[model samples]
Target chain A: LAKTTQPISMDSYEGQEVNITCSHNNIATNDYITWYQQFPSQGPRFIIQGYKTKVTNEVASLFIPADRKSSTLSLPRVSLSDTAVYYCLVGNSMDTGRRALTFGSGTRLQVQP
Target chain B: EAGVAQSPRYKIIEKRQSVAFWCNPISGHATLYWYQQILGQGPKLLIQFQNNGVVDDSQLPKDRFSAERLKGVDSTLKIQPAKLEDSAVYLCASSPRTSGGTYEQYFGPGTRLTVT
Candidate 1:
């Protein structure tokens, strides 16, 4: 498993586009970048995932460059309900050996109305 | 499809006491995981079960904590001699074994344990 670094906090106005980047300098070839969103008193939910290039889903988009050292999660048209803590994790293996994820202080996205 | 289900949304217990949390995974999910989420931190994997068998429990405190997934459908996680540091939310997640890496695991509401 590779360690990841991301911003501690970000502020954005509703309807604005927000891009949160995470750096995993030690990422391995098999490592995949995954982003999760967590609201207060709730379990984290998967937002998006990507191994390289760009991947888009209904909720968010994940961009991984050729180097794969860093990945960015892009959220379009933010709303008040989008305010939550975002976590970036790097891991491989379908089960990843059940490796406990060490979550750093996540980037708190505050969507202002 | 039903998501992972957990019981006793909130629990308050004194240190050294015992508490138990239950979880029912999504139908046909062969892989179930238990995680501990402390305040301001991400959920940490405490144990993982493949069906009714234990897969990994390296992070679990075996002396104080035990979990079982009997019948491969539902599971129970129990903590004896709880400590104040044990206060955290217990989250349950389940995923199909054949889903591969691209598939996402479903999470439950979680059991918030407060050991005072």
Candidate 2:
């Protein structure tokens, strides 16, 4: 499993865009980057996933650079309700069956008003 | 479709006592997972089941922690003589079969365990 690195915490005001970056220097060729959001007292929720380049969905956008060593999760127009811990996971889909995911401490985003 | 369901929502037990947690995965989901989440930390996978068979349980402390999915639908995790460090939330998640490709996971409201 590739170890992921992310900031411990981040703060942003409501309606502001928040970007969280994760670095997996040893990312494998088949590894895909997935981001999950977990609120207090709740299970982690899937927000977005991407292998490379840029992928956008209703919740957020995943930007993976050409090197694929790092990826960023961009949450637009955030709100107080969006305050949660964000996790960046790097692993291959096929490997998930044999190996469990290694979730980092995660980046705690405090969306303040 | 209904999401994964877990029972007891909360459990309080004294060290050296036994406790059990139950989970009902989403209907028709072939994959079930048990995770342990300590405060201020990310979840750690304790076990994984494919249908009624165990696929992986490398991280589970088998001496004290044991889990089973009898009918491949509902599962139970048991702890014998629980310890103080065992206090944490136990989460259950399910994912559709990935026979062809990748499938996203859906998590349930975890059961919080407090061992005093």
DockQ, each predicted model: 0.57, 0.60
**Model 2: how far is B67 from its true place, Å?**
0.4
Clashing residue pairs in candidate 2 are none
Model 2 stretches with alpha carbons more than 4 Å out: A97-100, B99-101
Chain A agreement with the truth for model 1, given as TM-score: 0.93
True contacts kept of each: 0.52, 0.55
lDDT of 2 by residue, A1-113 (tens): 68899999999999999999999999988788989999999999989888889999998999999999999999999999999999998876577533437888999999889
Q: State TM-scores per candidate.
A: 0.94, 0.96
Local distance difference test scores for all models: 0.88, 0.90
How large is the interface RMSD of candidate 2? 2.2
In the range A1-113, model 1's lDDT, one tens digit per residue, is 57789999999999999999999999877667888899998888988888899999998999999999999999999999999999998875464544425555689999999
**In model 2, what is chain B's TM-score?**
0.97
Tell me, by lDDT, which candidate is best: 2
DockQ of 1: 0.57
- The candidate maximizing TM-score is 2
lDDT of 2 by residue, B60-90 (tens): 9999999999988899999998999999999
